[model samples]
Target: MTAVGKQIREAILATGPISIAQYMQLSLTSPVGGYYTHGQVFGRTGDFVTSPEISQMFGEIMAIWYILHWEMMGRPTKTRFVELGPGRGTLMDDMLRAAKRFPQFFATIQGVEFVERSPELRRVQMEKLGCPKESMESVKDKNEPDTPGSAVSERYGGISVRWHTQLEEVSVESDCVPMVMAHEFFDALPIYKFEKGTSGWSEVLVDVDDSTTTPAPPQTTSARLAGSPHSSASDNSSECHFKFVRSRSVTSNAAVILRDPRFDSRFDKGDHVEVSAESARVMAVLADWVSQNNGLALIVDYGQDWTQGDTFRGIRKHKFANPLSQPGSMDLTADVDFSYLRLAAQGKAKCFGPVEQGKFLLDMGIQARLKQLLQATTDKKVQQDLVDCYKRLTDPNSMGRIYKVLAVLPNGAQGMPIPFAPPSKEELNRPKVEKIVRK
Candidate 1:
């Protein structure tokens, strides 16, 4: 019963219940059966492997944390090395091969956008960035031109490269700086699941049951009414049929049953819940284009550190499944709240380390880039598969304690490089059940 669950049960029998972020944006960008628009989900033959496909010492320690945040932003003659969702461009080819050891930060980098919206993964990021269409027209020659019937850009390329489809059409130039980056790009943004029953919250829909239309045999139901009287009906699945309405004055009236009746009535289980309000309004338009241009951002994903509950998930070949078994064919994600990304960088940016991508790649040196790739590969089983990909990227049992690492800057900025050290206030006020009892 998959072909994205028979096209989401014929779009809920031709329109009726759809919004778990519009069924995760048509199940991951629908340009025709979207599970990332048709396959090759990303290396080791797909399904999971990221962290720049797990090595090249994780993009050479994220190009030494973007050359210490481009020398803490002061070395900017022109900067703008963006990257939101640039997959298959292997972390921008290991961040331009670790920014060719600062050939003046690759000649002040000046251009390399790429927000991306799949023209077959933008021709696999223009054949893995052999770059050139005059360096992708030097980011459309820094925007605004075109007056008399514009085609803009007359010339440039002191190193450019563009391609955006969002991040508000990315074409910045004025006071440059804007250095952004994303790795697991905010956990594929799209989540909304609530479950706290009784009669106060019940939003988890995905309806289509007038007898399953002309295609039968996928029937499943549950919604046994009868509320109040200290309500309670926690487990009697058909997915979820909550009824926990207890309020002996009020300390537990919870009622939010949404477990997928497609996307039950959009919202109402304590409202304020959203997944990708276009990824927090494209991270508040990249923190107001790096706080009115003087930039810095760095994401890296797999999230948490916000509060509330539910962190929707799913994946396929590499395991953990049943995100409603096959709708748009698997791979839906969530958990990058980082406190609504620091309230979408509203204080005009200055967030740091949502930390724990194995302590920010072992504080950005990944064990000295894994001993310089085991002293340039001598091969004892290729140094035990690069010491088992650095213990699956710094093992706290894998993907280093559920992956995370955020950064934002643009407030009293100064030549970057301070990798880890900002996560306190008792480590961001502890308790989400101590991060699920420390996972």
Candidate 2:
């Protein structure tokens, strides 16, 4: 067992059971043995790979998208290019490099801020982007940036990057605009899983199973049966095991009552629903910033417009693992509910397509960019690699259909942003090509 696993087991043994949210938070952020707090977790060598790591084109396309929208927003003299969960700073680096074509947009960029909390990942980000000039500053709240002029110089470019632990720490002048990007970010935020009971929905908790000599159910209901679905549950050899059990109330203060009308009395006993208040809270803050200061936030992730069932899973060395089996040795993620995010933006900011990532990238002209790269390259291996990356990004069976993109704009904005504009009346009336599901 991992060190963090022992810590978690001890905590659960002392306290009755811990909510899934608490388990995830502890597993991912525990200062001493948390997964992210200890080591690198991106790219091929890590547990899983992200879009930005798959190809530089991903971030370059986003830069172009930003430029187009910035122009529509009047291209303010000072714009903050902010990114949340910037992994190794690859996306920001590519974005900065591509923004050079539009000198004004690139020059007008005030500061590139990253919202990251992991000290280990922060060092990795600084290595790629640029090391901080001084020790990182601590902020009291989200409204304040640590200190003015606290920036990290980019290794390749002259741009300076600032780091913040929370969205509230990212700040700008009253009149300045902030264009924010969060790629594959929302899924990582801790989520609460609730299962409908005979009484009502209750939060899921992790607990030690002393029911029998056999291994206990990990997550899926099938694991509770005589023939458990989990491979480990078949052993029946362990004296003690860890399993999921429902609890009436959450021990962690992070749990909140989810209020979505669609799910009202929708499930029979034993149905599951996942909620991410952290994701919603972050969106609320970002939406408020855009509505007040005028800018956009692009959120890209692999999720459905609305989600049900158990989407929470874990990854260790790129393969699926039981989420409850190991702590701080892998990544835990759940499918993002884009619809919930759009709901959070209501009244605060105007929301756009929670479109399929494939469709969004295509609409943003990824094919044109791909063709340019193919023509410029001569090595067959390089060409093949590019083709594979493109397919992974756009293939429906892959991220193309599974991943989604959401854009948040200032409320009452005049025109639509690129890749998210509504179709013409005639096109809308025709048989729709189901590339993306919009809310």
Candidate 3:
């Protein structure tokens, strides 16, 4: 077993079976050897590349979107530019660079907030951002009045930077509106898998074995299975035989995993599945924060339209790996159940997009951005590299298809550019597609 696996085994032995959320939380945030805590996980040498790493164009387009929203908000005198999980601050750097195009927009930006837990990463972000020392502040509380230039003295003309461990910790002074963005943040939350069985819906849980190693085990239940038909089956015979089996028989044999079950009630026996209450709770908190603070948030991640399906996945060294292995060393992620997220945000904030990242980027003028980059580059090799990066980011065959984007707006706001239109009934009725669409 790997070092991470050994540590996880020891934990499970001491604490018994842990919730999927707990497992994922430790895997990414543990102080010593967790994925984000131990080493760098970005850039060319990292486990995987994000949109910001792929091309600056991604962040530039996002900045344009933010500018549009700022305009919609009537260009508030003071606007909080916040980013959740600002990894290495590349996205923020690109955003700031792009925002410079609109001097008025930049001028209206009073503070920058980053919701991150890693001190090491905070150091890297500060160094890269060139933010002045006095500008580095933390949010106080909702009750506190706006400090304005207190965090940054009159001498400091640069944007003030604030760090908070959680969204709730960020102080929202009166009269200052907030605009938050999270790129590939929601998908990183842990997901629970559930399978429909003759008995009911059974949850997939990680349990410690006699050897003290934890492995996913299916719990039996009798709840009706949720979600569309399974997309692809590794075992061909199972797919061919599924039609012949009775509903109960099919449910018994079907290995479907529900992403969330916090709101689910009905169930029987022999049902197998999973859920992510923790993810839902996180979204609720975010939505509540935005609504209460007169702010908006945009979430960009890889997920499907709030539809029923399994999209749990893991990555290590840029390759797909078993989530059960190397507990704290690999990245475990799941498709953000936009449907559930939308439900969670209902009545609190306005939700938009949940559209594919491909469509979102295309709509944001990635093609135009590419042309500009091509014109600026003189070397043939360098031009080709830029072209390749553009393709990797916006090509339907690449990140475009699997990854998705969603936006949340403060309730009652208008005039923002619509990222995408809802899919038509015909489109929804089309045959199911595999969750993982690899190049």
Candidate 4:
């Protein structure tokens, strides 16, 4: 058993079976050999690759999108570019390098900010963005009092900035507005899974499998049924294992979530619904920030409009794995509930999109950008790679259909940003073709 795995087992034995959210929180960020605390989690070499690593195009396009929104906000000066979970800082670096073309937009930028929780990734990002080690500023947040990477920093690729441990740390009420980017961020936040049973909705929990004669933990629905019905799994078996049980804990958050209109209430018996209280909290923060500061926030991730349930699964080496099998060895994620995000942001910021990524990029002049790149490079291999990357990013069968974009802006912002606007007649009637960049 892994070190974290054993720690989790002992924790459950000492207290009781833990909630899925608790399990995920410990597995992903527990500091003692947690997944993000100590390993490669991004790129082709890591367990999974993000869109920013896929191609420079993603960030370049995002730079343009930011510029347009900045303009719509009256070209606010001293604005901050904040990225949540900026893996290796690739997207921010790409955006900084690409946005240089727009002198006004690039010049008015006061600083950049990154919200990262991983020490390993934070170092990698600092190195990637050329942020010197001498400019570090340490801060201790009450929420993450023990994390080493929770400090702020100065300068990112020559752009001034700081790293924050939480969103609430960055002051949104400043004279300068914040342009926030959250790519694949929401999916990583822990979600509570509720399974509707005969009695009602019960939270799903991780329990030590009953395999020996030891006493059962508190909050377990029933007594042990194996190896004398009271033995511990650690005593009966050498291998560490766990199982899922229906939660009957008195403090289940299901009742509150179900009652709040922020969540949907259409689950039937035997149905499972996954909700991320943290995600909703972040959305609320974003909405409040944008509304007050006349800021902009762009969220991109692989998700649907509240169409999936029970998607709390694991990924190891780009393939699906049992989420409960290896706690800290794999990446656990659930689909982003964009509809929930929209609902959470309602009455605060003006939310646009939850649109398909393919359409969003296509409408935002990605095709035109691709043409410029293709024409600039004569190196056949480089050109081919670019084309392939473009296809992967924009193709319907790949990230296009699966990934989505949601834009949040102050309700008083002037006009709709590009791509989110209704499609033109010509755009609606274009023929589909591979390897061809559509205008």
Candidate 5:
């Protein structure tokens, strides 16, 4: 078992089973032993590959998208370009480089801010993005004031790259357009899973049983002695596991589960539904930010418009694994429901697209970009590699159909942004998926 796994196992044994959200939180962000707290987790060497790492053309196209959107926003003199969870900062690096072609648009931006939680990832981002490392850690939350380590500005190619752990820390001037991007971010937010029962809905929890086998690094064995009451005397073979249990009572919110449009009527007993309160909260906060600042945000991730099933799973070494088996040693993620995201942003901002990523990229001229790169390169192997990457990003069997893009702009903003068309009639008729049934 991993060190973090033992910690989690001990928690469950002592305090009873934990909510899926709590389990995910500790697994991904434990600060001391979280999967993301240390080491490299991106690109070929990482657990999984993101679109930005697939091809430079993806980021370049996004640069064009940003440029067009900035123009649509009247090219505000002072704007902020913020990226959430900027892994290694490759996308931003390509984006800023492409923006150089339009000097006016590039110069109009006053700051390039990154919102990240991992100190290790932030260092990687700084190195890859040509931004200098901060002398101290930034303020931890939005409500907190600048401490000794708060976001001091650093520049790369004349663009200031400010680092913050929370969105609220990135200062926005009055009327300054905040162009925010959250590529492959929402999926990482912890989600709550509820199983439909004959009586009602029950929350899913992680438990320990004989089938559960603790994963290894050798040191994790000591974790059992560190806290769990079921120490060496008990069967050492027991492993972390998953199970479902009913809550004490249906709260006012849980009473509304049947009404949530995210789940279809087809769901019967034992059907599972996952909802991410953290994702919705982030979306609400983002909508509020855009609404207040007259800004825009682009969200891209692998998910469906509406979903009903267990999408939560773990990824280790680019392969799937049982999430409960390897706490704090692998990446845990769930499919994002773009429908809920749109609903969360409603009234405060105009939500657009949740369009297929392949369609969005094609519409944004990825083909032309690919051809341009192909022509520039004379090497056969490089040409074939580029083609393969292009196909991987656009092919229906790959990321094309599974991944989606969403846009949120200030409520009264006129016209559609680039790569997003006016809403289709079918999309117009779809019912909005309201907030999740609070656990």
Candidate 6:
């Protein structure tokens, strides 16, 4: 068994069982062997590839989307772009580079902020975003007196950037507009599984499988984060030795989550309900931020508005793997419950989409951009690669239909963001005119 497995086993034996959320938090962030702490976890060599890594076009379109919203929001001079869990800062880099073409939008950028926790990932982002190593760490910015963690970086074309471990650390400004992006982020938040029983819903917990051989002893594990208890990140064994156990009675989590009046109907059909309290909490906080600061937030991920099936699984090297087999070896994720997200932000913010990615991109003119790129490049390989990436991103059979886009705007908003915006008078009446002519 891996050191992570041994530590988990020891902990479980010491206690009884752990919630799925607890398991995932330990596996992905544990400093001893945490996935994000030790080494690279992106691109061809890493575990998974994200949209920005797939192509520059994804970020360019994102830049366009933000520019439109910036205009809709009255084009504040000091609009800050923030990304949660920015991996290698690829998306931000691509988006910022595209924004440079539009001098107005680029000039409006006061600075960029990344809400990342991993020290290693922070270094990688600093390098990728061209923030020099000598850039002052924990350096106080006179302009932003409230942000003690803020570091003024002379990178990314002179735009001062800062990295914070938590969202609260990045202080908000009353006069500045905040635009936040969370691409494939919420899925990583811990989720609790509940199954309907004869009386009420019971929570699923992870335990040692009696059928599996457990012969290894515990190893010295390290802490991944200050508050997080972690196992060795090097302890991934690629074999799931854990078993799922259900609580005989209703759990406190189930009672509260399954009873949220705003989201009660969401659990009506599902025999199994996967609830992410952390996701909802984060969403609520985000809603409050946007509503107060007149900000906009875009969330892109693979999930449904409401789900009746199990979406919890593990991934290693881009292929599906047993989530319980090897504790820390694989990445654990569940489909985002977008309905839950909407409900969480219900009273505080205006929600748009849960739109299909294909529709969103096409509406944002991805095809036009693709054609432009294709025409500009003569190399057959590069063109083919771009075309493949485009197809993968927008094709219905692939990421198009599966991946979804959700946006959040401050309450009492008049204008809608692009694609999700209401149709113009001409657009609304065009189909009727065409029908009459055909008759």
TM-score of each: 0.32, 0.85, 0.78, 0.84, 0.85, 0.85
Off by over 4 Å in 1: 1-9, 14-22, 25-27, 31-61, 66-94, 102-119, 122-124, 131-184, 187-190, 199-201, 206-304, 308-335, 338-418, 426-439
- Which regions in candidate 3 have their CA more than 4 angstroms from the true location? 1-7, 132-157, 209-274, 307-310, 422-425, 428-439
Q: What is the Cα-based TM-score of model 3?
A: 0.78
Q: Residues 169-230, candidate 6, lDDT per residue (tens digit)?
A: 77667888888999989988989998766576788999988675533322221111101112
> Could you give candidate 2's per-residue lDDT for residues 152-248 as a string of tens digits?
5654345566777888877787767888999878888988888766755677878976565444424432111111112232222223346888776
After superposing candidate 4 on the true structure, give the runs of residues whose Cα lies further than 4 Å from its correct spot.
Answer: 138-157, 210-240, 248-251, 261-265, 422-439
- Which wins on lDDT, candidate 3 or candidate 4? 4
What digit string (tens of lDDT, one per residue) describes model 3 on residues 280-368?
Answer: 77788888888888888888876665443344544555554456556665667776667778888888888876777778888888899
Residue-level lDDT tens digits of model 5 in 1-439 = 7778777878988987777888899999996589888658776777677888888999998889888887776777877789999988899888877887898987787767888888777767766766444544555565433322323334444556667778887778896788899998888898887777777666666666545345421211211021112222322233455444545554333455336643546456667778887888889998988888888888988877875456677666555556776578677888888978888788888998788888999999999999999999999999998998898788776778878889888888887777778778987897643334334
State the weakest 10-residue window (summed lDDT) of model 2. Answer: 221-230
TM-score quality measure for candidate 5: 0.85
lDDT of 6 at 101: 91
Error at 194, model 3, angstroms: 2.3
lDDT of 6 at 313: 72
- In candidate 3, residue 396 scores what lDDT? 65
Task: Please give the range of 10 consecutive residues that has the lowest summed lDDT in model 1.
Answer: 221-230
- Clashing residue pairs in candidate 5 are 1-214, 1-215, 212-239
Please give the lDDT score at residue 325 for candidate 6: 67
TM-score of structure candidate 4? 0.84
Give candidate 2's total backbone clashes.
2
